[model samples]
Target: MNVLFNTDKLTRLIANLQTFTGIRTNTFDAAGKDIQLSGGHSDFCRLINASPEGHARCEACDARAVEKCLTARNAYSYRCHAGACETVLPVFESGTPIAYLVFGQLLDDSSVKQQWENAEKELGWYQGDLAELKEAFLRLRRFSPREMAAYAEILEALAQYIQQEGIIRSAEYSDLQKLEMYLDRHYMENLSLKRISADLHMGTTKLCTLSKKLSGGRTLTWLIAQRRVNAAKSLLLKSDEPVSSVAESVGFSDYNYFTKIFKSVTGITPSAYRKTNRS
Candidate 1:
């Protein structure tokens, strides 16, 4: 399920908070999928990212925490799978929970050496350089329990904001968020109206109507293509992979067609864009 909050506004808030609190934060839907800042994942998360087994374990950890918050009917904090403290604040709608404002991955007050040893054990068998992981652990934001409570209050306020704004901008934007969530999950695939509408369980026409309204008149296809182009741009700028491979990675199968769309959307060829960005 999508978070019932303004992601852009929340992102801006998270960014600003980092400047003051030096703590990273993220919001997740009730299902544990990140919807906002989710701040640069902790160093230990980087290790888990490398191994599918460990990633699954971490997901299960998140699932359990989400379950506890949903069942307990209150916001709470728990230690992450990687030995860092984290909190989950459920955002409710009309007396039902819809999303969670998650803040955490901070180190507890203790000996740094012991913390690393415990983190290595908690992270289990994974493949990133342990030294790097240690560095990341050392760099994590640390706070006392009192400070954490104060930070969580910020997320609570934002959650309340989402609940209020949602009343004024309900169904239309909800449909928009649903579409965005779908695109975020399936952006790597060859997507189309029939498939997207099917997933949302709505007719293509209504889907298009909502997409148009949500995007201020841009068609559903526009958003899909834009998402792909944006991904392609990231790959182009960040990786040394070839243009054709980058195009394919972002859901474009035909290299020439990918170039056409890339140029059309970005006003430059992929190679040129890459070179310019590199320079």
Candidate 2:
């Protein structure tokens, strides 16, 4: 999914928050892919990620937290697998989540000793140096219950600022725009009219009509060809790969057909286009 946002601005905002709070913050797309402003992972987390088993458990823990946050439709805080407290807040647009803001890699002051005992027992399977892990764990910041609640409020307000300022947004697309986005993302795959129709939930005939109307009488097939040719052109200009290799990369299996389509779209052969454009 393509999330529209001012990445630099979002980074600045989150970085400022991290600087002020002494806590790490990160942004993730709806699909759980990191966006930017990772603020750096805590030493505790780095240690967890370094162990293969610990890494897998950490990912599972994060996935569950994201799912819970989506279910609550608000910030959800929980004790991580390794016992640090973390919170996740989903940024919603039109009742749909576009992004997530996650903060908190700290412990609660009231439960530090008990939580550490739990963490040590839980991570007993970890193969790394246990003493170093304990040192990192003990170094985590601690907040009282009241302070944690206040931090949650601060995170909520930050989420609101991100939404109100349009730092992250989900674009509402027209049918044509939807088609274009789908094609752009899937152009490297084996695409057919039937597959497009099924995916878009539009009848094949209606899709054909819409394609013609939006594309000035061009067919969907032509649009796909044009998309592939455009991608090929970028590769041709930017890389020294062979034209045939470029053809395969852009979904054209047959070199002869790729040459024909390239010529038909750009009024020049791929090789010639590359030679002239590069010069």
Candidate 3:
């Protein structure tokens, strides 16, 4: 049984999980768009951003992670091209692959030092580059094989949480499902309950009732916020647009109000989110 994820709830839960484990988590949709857990990139990831070549190498690591996770049908761990250990887990419900959860980007200090020397001597790393990375390299989190295995267990449990939280009776959402899909497609537009009701050819009262039921007690406004905020996240990460422009692009006209709602939804300002998540 496929399910459309509740992005807000799962993002909040993933945030708490990251805090608990001191490990990062990221989720991506089937289309490869990040829907939740978009930030908190590890220092190993940062080091790879030092150059275009290094960034390409980092992409290789990410591709490897994705392939391993999907192929294994469970958690997959490997040493990244940047000398850090990483893991990814495929998220599936009822045999349909919908998303992925990635975790554990950690570097061993000694391994990093050796790789740094090798990079400088063989890979054309600049004179001051490796030195500049010393701090973040030393600070990069490390985990043993056994520990990563344990983290995989924890991630397995959390993956179940996302699946279970998304579980709702399908019979109750026939009309609501169509509405939900429409909202997801057009959430960037100026939408209203009245407009939606008219388009659905249903009475306002009936629309409101069905909306409440579909949202599990949330109003349609909540649905809008969820869609817009997630869209804002993708924009903030994928481009260098200004926060105000990003706000407007996501259907939030008032910059201040957008900042307030963005912080409320993501626990960080738009600027901070971009800074943390940008490649």
- Cα error, residue 119 of model 2, in Å, equals 0.8
TM-score of candidate 3 to 2 decimals = 0.53
Per TM-score, the best of the predicted structures is 2
When summed lDDT is taken over every stretch of 10 residues in candidate 1, the lowest stretch is 165-174
Candidate 1 C-alpha lDDT tens digits along 83-154: 778898878876677777777778767676787787778665666677887887788777888878877787
Query: lDDT by residue for model 2 over 156-237, one digit each (tens)?
Result: 8878788877788765334566888899999878999999999998788978887886578999999889899999999999
Let me know the TM-score candidate 1 reaches against the reference structure.
Answer: 0.56
Query: Per model, how many backbone clashes are there?
Result: 1, 0, 0
Q: Candidate 1 lDDT (Cα, whole model)?
A: 0.78
1 or 3, which is superior by lDDT?
1
Model 3: ten consecutive residues of lowest lDDT? 165-174
Give TM-scores for every candidate, taking all chains together and pairing residue i with residue i.
Answer: 0.56, 0.61, 0.53
Question: What shift in Å separates residue 71 of candidate 1 from its native position after superposition?
Answer: 1.5
